[model samples]
Target: MRIALLSYSTKPRGGVVHTLALAEALAALGEDVTVWTLGRGGDEGFFRAVDPAVHLRIVPFPDGPQNEGVGPRIIRSIAVLRDAFDPVAAKYDIVHAQDCISANAVLPSGRCIRTVHHLDQFTTPELAACHERAIVEPDAHVCVSRSVADELARGWGIKAEVIPNGVAYERFADTDPAARRAWKQRLGHYILTVGGIEPRKGSLDLLEAYALLRTKHPDPALVIAGGETLFDYRDYRARWEARAQELGVQPIVLGPVPDDDLPPLVAAADAFAFPSVKEGFGLAAMEALAAGTPLVVRDLPVLREVFADAARFAATPATLAEQLSAALTAADPRRQTAGRRLAAQHTWTEAARRHLDFYRRAGQR
Candidate 1:
């Protein structure tokens, strides 16, 4: 089958990760797959090396004025990708879009298979329109978790196919001891969270939780990595920094760690914290679990549906702090083993096979 996967950016966001890994898995299964994405900030390729079997088509998307609002940027993004992708949009057997921008771009190509990773509430007219069109315009929809699928059903009256994300189980689970030790030596006993400083990531809430955790246990430091985002969050970050100063806590902000260093970084952590307010699937948290790291996540329905008993859940900042403390101090080999087993079970091959079946069924329609 000829499949073309579309994504909004070439960055290391969760949806982009899904695109590259799924493309590789599909290619491995004797399917011809190509990934289409915008190369933001002059990027010519993805954050990491992709599989040789899967083809790449990176459309150049230049940066706008530094002060340009998100609405205009989103409009420009759709225009650039749509112009580049429209000519070849009809050539693929499946035109699957991974995000709102990509889905909006290829929405006019007659048929679209959109993966609603998560829904966002937008106020800007252009963004809200883009979000709604991406949700309802697609011929078929796919969601990464059953909770999100249920949301589509209840809110939009759309029955999206439920397809959970697959993690790189062996890559994280097999980190070398020396590499893990190197990270541990550099940052002694830290609580780590990825996905940069953004509102949806609940960065402010995490900051408060970390401060509370320090009141009782001052041994563990807070380490934050991976904050590459297209949206402007300087205000939110400033608030976070101001709050950090007010609380007399300094979190090590490592913005966008190299791809190779991610696994060891996850492995060396005393505990991994995921305080996202909205998430279709907790991909980074799952990676931490694969590395045999204790996990503490916000009590969200999607996370509960996905992580199940493998993670400790917390609803409030105080509860989150408590959970992090417990994760750092307690040694529950049983939950650790369960986490590893859960991560191992969500393989890309199985995901690709299910996607192929979905494509075949959708094509019949």
Candidate 2:
């Protein structure tokens, strides 16, 4: 089988990560897989290295002039990617798009499969249009969680196949002790969250929670890691900064942690915080579980569906703070063991087999 997996950017966003991982997994199954993505800002490769077996096509997407409106930029993005991708569409047995932008780029041909990682309520007119078309135009749909699949059904009477995300369990579970020790030495005892400060990530809420948490545990620091994104969040970031100052919370903001050092950073953390307002699957939190780190995630339907009892949940900042404090002080070894087992059960090989099954079925349809 030949597959072309499409994603919008080469950044460290969840969907891009999924695209690369799934491509490698599919290649391991003796399938011809090529990953396609826009090389935004001259990025010649992915945030991390990919398996040599999978082919890559990074289309050049240069940044537009300063003060370009979001709407025009989005339209231009679709145009550039679509023009770059159309010539290569016929080479693959399956052209699966991983996000709205990539899905939109492929939709003109009307012969693409799309993975709806999650549904979002977009207020911008262009984004709203892109989101809707991506959902409705794809020949077949895939979702990472049943919660998101259900959202598609409720919103548009669309039925999507559910395939859970696979975690790189051993990479995190067997982190180098020296690397872990080095991170611990640098950051000290801390709580960590990836994905940066954005509105959707509940950055302000986490800040509030961190402030409350400091009342009891002032020694353990709050560290934010990976944060490379395409969206504009300056207003939200400014608000977060103001709140942090008001709360007297000084978090160690290590933006875009090096890919090689991420596992050890996750491993060394006292607990991992995933207080996102929305999510398809809590991939970072799952990686933390793989590393035997206690995790606290927001109480969302998707998270509840994915995590169940393997993690602690909170709805509000105060409750989030409470959960973090408890997770820091009294993490149960039994839960940690269960988490490790759960992470082990979700392997890329299993995910790949299921994806192949889906591709065959969708092709027949």
Candidate 3:
């Protein structure tokens, strides 16, 4: 089948990573999948980073200032949608939108399906309106987790199919001892947390918890890895660092690492800690499990669904620290083995098969 995967922002974020993985898997299964994106004129390095097997089409826009105002941003987005859809919509059998925000303006024609990563938690009236419109109008909606689906049904009265995110397992199988040793020398015996520095990600809470743990384990460093420039959430990292200093905790913040470097970085961790307030699907935690690193994550519904009995769950950062400490001190070979086995089952190939099945069924309706 010919499919068009539509996304507004195709940066190397979690959602974009998921989209690219699924697209690559679908192409491997002998499907014609083309990714449609807004052409953000850079060195095109990011697009080159994606697997060459998957097809890509960048819809162009007129030249303008580096950063446009809100009004111009909306106008430019509309222009991009028009340009993308004019030539491609009739040729493809299916169009799968990657996010509700992008789907809001593009899916009203009833020619596409939307996958809701999560609802907009922004308090802005315009953002809320856009989210409501997308939630109510999609031909069909797919959610990344059951918790997300439930929230949509409860709050917006929309029933969405739940499909969990999948990982590229083979990437984490091999180890590089030299790389690990270099990272270890830079940040010794550190507790790792991977995600963008944001308030909802619990970066501040992690600092608080690390402070509490420092009295007993004075030298165990905390490493924060992910993109540093979160446009809306830029203050979160500064606030966290200030708090860490005040509490006298050993905190090292390493901004985003490359995709190829992620596996070794995750594997090198003494233990992985995820103190997020919420998640549609905890991809980093899953990666940790595949790397055979012990996990300490928030005891939330979605996390429970993903890790089940394989991970140690804690509700608060203090509890998270305690659980991580215990896991690090007395490593369980059986649990690590079981976690790796479970992680193996959640491969991108399987996720792509499920997505294809859903697309076929949805198209028939």
Candidate 4:
């Protein structure tokens, strides 16, 4: 099968990560897979090196004029991506889009499949339109979690197939002890969170929770890593910094960890924190599970659906702190074992087979 997978940016966002991994998995099945993406911020390639089996097409997209609003930038992004993606419709059997921007770009071309990772309410007019169109226009839709698929059905009256994300189980589960020790030496005992300090990530809430957590466990540090984003979060970040100062909490912020360094870093953490306000599959937390790290995630349906009894959950900052403290101090062995088992169950190879089956079904339609 000739499959063309499209993503908005070559960044380290969840959807982009899914696109790269899925493409490689499909290629491993002896299928012809090509990944199409916009190379924002002068990126020559994806954040990490992609497998040689999968073909890559990174479209150059330079920065726009200074002070360009998010709306204009989004419109420009659509135009640029649409202009670059011109695959022969007859050649490719499936053109699957991974995000709203990519879905919008491909919708007009006919019969594109979209994976709705999660539903978001965009304030920007252009982004709002793009999001709605992407949801409504795709020929078929898939969601990583049943909760998100239910949301799609409730809001748009559209039934979407549910196909959960696959994790790089062995990569994290088999992290070298020496490498993990190296990270432990560098960062000390810490509670770690990936995906950066953004609003949707519940950054401010985490700061509040960390502050409370410090009262009980002052020794462990709060470390944040991997925050590469397309939208401007300067205002939200400023507020977060101010609140951190007010709460007298100093968090160690490592901008973006290299691909090779990530597994050990995850393995070294005393506990992993995932307090996102929204999520599809909680992939990062799953990876933390693969590393045998105790996890404390936000109490959301999607997260509950994904993690189940494998993770500790919290709703508010106070509860979040309480949960983090418990996970850090004395994590349950049963939960740790369960988490590892859950992560190991979700393999890229299995996900690839399911995707191929979905493609065949979509083709029949």
Model 3 segments beyond 4 Å from truth? 39-48, 60-82, 228-230
**Across residues 229-311, which tens digit of lDDT does each residue of candidate 4 receive?**
88999999999999999999999999898999999999999999999999999999999999999999999999999999999
Of 3 and 4, the candidate ahead on TM-score is 4
Per-candidate TM-scores read 0.99, 0.98, 0.91, 0.98
Pairs clashing within candidate 2: none
Candidate 4: worst-modelled 10 consecutive residues by lDDT = 83-92
lDDT of 2 by residue, 35-116 (tens): 9888988899999999999999999998898987777778888989899888878877898999999989987755899999
The TM-score measured for candidate 2 stands at: 0.98
TM-score of 1: 0.99
lDDT tens readout by residue for model 3, 10-68: 56667777788888999999999987766655323343377677788766645568665
lDDT of 1 by residue, 1-365 (tens): 88999999888889899999999999999999999999988999999999999999999988789788999999999999999989988889999999999999999776999999998998888999999999998999999999999999999999999988999999999998999999989999899999999999999999999999998899899999998887878989999999999999999999998899999999999999999999999999999999999999999999999999999999999999999989978799999999999999999999999999999999999
What are the lDDT scores of the predictions, listed in order?
Answer: 0.94, 0.91, 0.77, 0.92
The alpha-carbon lDDT assigned to residue 354 of candidate 2 equals 95
Winner by TM-score between candidate 3 and candidate 2: 2
Candidate 1 lDDT (Cα, 0 to 1): 0.94
